[model samples]
Target: MTKGRPGENPAERPRAAVMEDVAELAGVSAMTVSRVLNAPEKVRPETRARVLAAVRELDYRPNSAARVLVTGRSGVLGVVCFDTTLYGPASTLFGIEQAARDSDYLVSIASLPALNRRWITRGIDRLRSQSVDGVIVVAPHESAAEGLRNLPPGLPVVDVGGGADLPVPVAAVDQFAGAARATRHLLSLGHRTVWHLSGPPNWIDASGRVAGWRSVLEAEGREIPEPLVGDWTAHSGYEIGKRLAREPGVTAIFVANDHMAMGVLRALRETGRRVPEDVSVVGFDDVPEAAYFWPPLTTVRQNFGEVGRQAFQLLLDRIAGMEGEARRMVEPELVVRESTGVSP
Candidate 1:
């Protein structure tokens, strides 16, 4: 194999492998080698296999820039997301990469510092400048979803659970449904009233959770207490949890995220309350550590990978000039564990 070792017997610059080298090794014209790489069907199987064998031996990779010039397609997809290192967005990003690589497309990313209309518009503009065939915006905020209206007409965009009333297509977890299910589970457990510790107000996910929790309470004709807000941080959860733990009717709580739930667990312990005895807690985003938390958190599981994969699928359909925009919604499941139990 001519896969030269980079630092072997160091020289000014080791020779770079090229298609001509592969062509020469295969005993074929350069055009035949090109056909083998781009349109192998046009060449006889035997000849194509021979060219490919030489290509492997020489460690040859075609210049993507040159290939794009010839084929109008960059074979690249752009993903736009927010700056935070939150699990949902990060996992969704990972899912996008996995799906893109599997589909033989390269990925480019643009992370916005905030999730506002102007910032989202700027993020889209930056990706478009890279000549991306399409973009998938990992927008979990209501405002960011609204910004999709300003997208360049027919740019083939997909919003990853952005929110309601978006002009573009969406692929997302049904945040409202997931939250409602969690609330219902607690209500069914005989808790008279279930309290909520929500994420930041601007995020659609946080708002949806609050709405779901409130809807169930209202539906049952139970008292609808105001939701305590957190910034999706364990620290925020701890802060709000301390306050909730002191309240008389805070026997059950549905937190917005798992990280926050951990904090609440600590707060409850500090306040002389025993889990599943005096209080029960449920969290969202079944993070890996949720199971290891004291009392093993009960939570909602958002299929983040599914959200990402479906988003890519919707983007693919749009990029191919399909007739209409399609919004794909994935439902979440309620996971019961030690943290949840029959009301004390």
Candidate 2:
């Protein structure tokens, strides 16, 4: 036996708690605790609650090493995505971690600085080396989604914000509908013609928003102006906004995200153009800061939390050998704020 540390009293001290201790405290068998931890759906709600309560009270955590040795499985999920500093991707990552925790699993994450076929493969490989049961990729850009198509066979995978008609399962926001709604709302406010500032062409979300905006303009018989393109940044928006501010006929503009909207607002202010008075501005991804923007921002709200949870569920289902139509789309909502008003 390993020698105990100095001053340690192994004989008098209670041993670290085990699953059996938790089961006894909850008045259930050890197998029940196992089921609750592994296949919670199989256990009745009441029993699962009781076991979980006991687990919490006892501060019980399964012995991952022993469990892995016996089961040849790691009770962990991997989340692979780009930077988490951006609001949307960050929120999705948070949601995925929360969902994994609630389901009694740990999460390993690989955040790439830039996404490419080689980097994505390396990230997946890193997680695979750790034996994560499955992975969820937040592949908004085309390149990231393309890398996913070449993943090794038998790896359970899901994607959040994947490209259109992706072969793998995906959970994404209905960007098209949300964009249409935002544009339609502006048209309802009597904007004769609405201009758009689109996100980068490489992102599916960006393309979907552009398509939706285009469809609305076409339907209303309005002439479409060339949309300004942004790399989904405030700086890009500022540059585009400066040009639009110089145009007297540009009365209404829809930006692809709130970050860009802020830039546009600033650019308009600098150019002596008034929001709602001279030009009505709308943005997408009703981020937390949207409501706090100067004059606030009317925008589309994609429930990234829900999308992440759905991706987690889909991945889990695949890991359990169930598959088909795992692609799920969460609808986006248009939130009205002070930034948009009767088009001048």
Candidate 3:
């Protein structure tokens, strides 16, 4: 027996000894010992028990880094996101993390700043250097599409909402369709015409929504009024709402997102306009708080969790050399609430 070090318990030894000695005593290979540690269910119960007993006897602890080096698989996936604080991107990240954990994989996130070309390029380069098995990019801005043009070939990527035209596999909620549905619902309520509050024009989703709202109204032969723009914020929505409140003959409105709709609600209330009474409102992105709005909100629901799950799976498939269409679109659902009603 090895003597203990000075002021240390002489009986204890480093954990690495346990792993090596266990493999030797159990008459198994080191790779077998690793499999037993990393994937217990894959090893036969009898062999696994023997490894466990030897491990206990030798006090062995396997090193994860060594295992990763030998296997060439870190079991990690990298996610690049823009606007980490945004409701949709944040929720998608949570979903991706949870799904990765469930699949016995690790997720690492890198938040891109403002979805600019330089930020996206640098983020992707950083993730590549980390040896991530694949990458999922939450590219909600138009600049992301431009960035995609510069990505190195054959790097597995799944884009979320970069644009309608994608060079790699993509998973996105159908913003255009959702916006059209919201507009149609308001029109069906007997509103002569509907006004729009749009998000920042540079975002792909915002552009799709704006186009959808415009196309629907134009198809119905309704007069299309100039849409007010917001920065996907409640404050911007409120500002636009204030302007709408002062305008005459504005009976119905569709705001780009629920957060902004909250601002619209505040403005309408301050201006003495009752929702669904003097004015009706509908919004996109049925965020959790939408239901709790004063009169509740009528909005479009984008299933961001589903988007993340599908995007990750698509990336994995791509990494495995699977071939399929590069773009995929998810449909959104229109949620009806108390905020919209028949026009007077």
Candidate 4:
């Protein structure tokens, strides 16, 4: 066996690199190292460079627990969302993660099976246990509003696609405006009145869209046709579309989402009705696949990325003990396409 160096234990494991090691290596105080890691703007360029170089050389990772103890922040944000299989929620979550990454913050996500008060609270608790600086809840269902009202005190919370009366700050795409635009677009094409294929009633987004669509029809003194509710799935849209396809009065249809709109298109095609000819269609959520639907869909584009960024910013503000706007809404755009045209 090789002999060990004097007083050196060769069998002992090496000590892990720490912030103090980086500070010593960079010829700076531990405070300077902390500043460089947490608030680099406060450190001089030369000092920051030296600290960064030392950090790389030592492969030093700031101890999150120790940093949280010292600074009261973990640099980790939490996201509580539901069933990411759907496009809207999934895209919103993706946007939040992207924004967090750009800001050099880590994201810890808690995806729940349901949007009820029980599930939402549990999700928040799980994130809180992980020492997240703040949390953004992406539950857009009516059931979640009640849960939001009952959250534990003092933690910064932001809601995405939630109701306006929420106790916490809110950042969401203007679903009402988007739905209204879709309804108005169909009406602009000279359709007598637009019919609506809405999402489930329990969803806040669905209710907002319904209200917007209904508002337009009522304001214009047009016939207010009852909306058919779907489960925000293409299958639901297809089933509902089949019923609408048989009705001659259904000249224009405003769907709550693109997936359902695609279903409607299929139903119309199978029923021998040419889109934008015998019947026009408009949908919300300009999902990527919307443009490829046989007759490309004319839909409302929700700026989910902007909403996510705004939500993250709002959380940051709250975490910093700043009081600002309670709500921020990203405007949705109307994208006209082949699916909608003048009434024949």
Candidate 5:
């Protein structure tokens, strides 16, 4: 009887591949494979290419559990945010997760029940217990930003959408610049002065926008109408818009966000005010539906994706013990649509 070579039976399951198998297949030492996987920049380009080819050929995946045991790093990141229900925060979370995935790291989120010192501390503790390599905080409210300033030292941390001059690194859209641009656009169109509809008073974004809008009006020596504060919602915008519609001198208005702008549009229409013809409107945050708004909303386009990417990169740098630029502010663009026009 011919003996089939020891364990070559077709019915036998192929063994799971390991780093040793990959190293052998690539004609390299196990240490070389390790360097290639962990720090590819330190490995010769030709050597890395060969090891990668072997890994693909065997469909090898790194043993993350074993890696943690050996290196004391879980290869995970922590994210702390107040609410993901809102568009800005939700989008920022998505961006961070996407960035983490691209870098072969896992994300563990701790959504806070409230934006305060106690909750922030609890969130960081939860993540620390999981052995996260670093953390990214996505809290835009002043209370949360203030809490971040005194976080217990040791863990690498970065802040997203937080205020300027933070103790940790920060990544955010230049809210001031965006609002200023919107105000300038209205002024350029021959509007005597642009009124403002701002977001909640507690948010850093709202304050930045207010400062920007006021700065422009002051520099241009234009009449600065007192800004109407809203809760960053359509209803608030509608309520405020109704009041503005009744004012005869209100020719141009800059709103903090798109949802409020939609409400303002409705309020104007119901009050017999034709948009642009009677009241030109401009809003921030070019939400997906902004362009579809009746007459299309002229708004500021914030690159949340870029903000997320920068936040992730900052965390990575912090983890590596690098002291790079502490704050990276992304520039926002102005999108012109049919909702705005020359003062009429």
Candidate 6:
């Protein structure tokens, strides 16, 4: 009977004491007792019950810190993200959080200022201090991918969107396919050519969408014009739309995201360009407001939620040393609405 320190009773020394007692009473090793606590499925049912009963009798509570020390896993996932206010990133994070909750894992979010290497490295180091099991990065910029290349070896990582080349798994929406679909849909409505208003060139999603749009036009032998670029903002879209409204031979337009499309809509209305009649419009990322736009926007709906879930799942798989491809792409769907009409 060893005496505990001040303020500690020998009967209730701590979780370690209780676990040791349980192991002795159940005639099992301490490692076996720990296995039963952490992964009950690994232990035989009868043995598991015996250990559990012993735990109850001794009033034993498992020590999470001790478990982490033994397993070298914190059971926590770190998420590094940017654009927290944006629809795509926010929705995706929600899905990831939900999935993590379902799996009994905790998430710690580190919002990076930008996708620069310094910021990303800092975020990673911060998460590492917490001893997270793995990390999920949710920036979809070219710079983000470049930053990921600098990470140390053997750390499991999952990329949500950033076109950044990743060492671990990567999950994202198929922006190119979605853009192609949008373009083809416009052409089908008898528009000779569909103009494009792109997001910042640095974003991987923006680049993919632009590529898809160009590929469709080039395949049909339609003349491709210089794409108007915006900064993924409604105001930028509006500015580009104003200029586009005055451009000769422009009848249909494909904007990169819904927010910009709203701005385009405003510009079109102010310029007296009747939507779907004089000029049809299609946008990407069917945001909540896309439906409520004066005329519902015909836009591509990206599966951001699915991206988040898949990103987390992929990271978990990598952490568990499962065999699978490191890259995954989610497909986006085109939603037809009042914004597009048959060419007169």
Model 6 per-residue lDDT tens digits across residues 129-218: 888898898888877776688776667888887563466578999999999999999999999999999999988989999999999999
lDDT of 1 by residue, 108-225 (tens): 9999987788998998999888778899999788778667877897588888877777888889888889999999999999999899999999988999889888998999999888
TM-score, cand. 2: 0.84
Clashes counted in candidate 3 amount to: 3
Off by over 4 Å in 2: 1-62
Q: lDDT tens string, model 3, 1-344?
A: 65554336755764346465678888899878888987999999999999989988767766657666777666788889987789999888887887888887888888875668888888888987877778898978888877877787767888987686677788889998999999999999999999999999998888999899999999999999998889999999899899999876899999999999999999999998999898999988889989999789999999989888888788878878997777667899999999999997
lDDT for every model? Answer: 0.88, 0.89, 0.86, 0.91, 0.91, 0.87
Location of the lowest summed lDDT over 10 successive residues in candidate 5 = 1-10
Q: List the residue pairs that clash in candidate 5.
A: none
Error of model 4, residue 205, in angstroms: 0.8
Error of 6 at 296 (Å): 0.4
C-alpha TM-scores of all predictions:
0.90, 0.84, 0.90, 0.91, 0.84, 0.86
Count backbone overlaps in model 5: 0
Backbone clashes (count) for model 6 = 3
Relative to the unseen true structure, what is the Cα RMSD of model 2? 4.9
Query: Ten-residue segment with the worst summed lDDT in candidate 6?
Result: 6-15
Number of clashes in every candidate structure? 0, 0, 3, 0, 0, 3
Which candidate ranks first by TM-score, i.e. highest?
Answer: 4
Per-residue lDDT of candidate 4, residues 195-312 (tens digit): 9999999999999999999999999999999999999999999999999999998899999999999999999999999998999999898999889998999999998888888999
RMSD of each: 3.9, 4.9, 3.2, 3.3, 5.0, 3.6
Error of 5 at 321 (Å): 0.6
Judging by lDDT against the true structure, name the best candidate.
5
TM-score order, best first, reads 4, 1, 3, 6, 2, 5
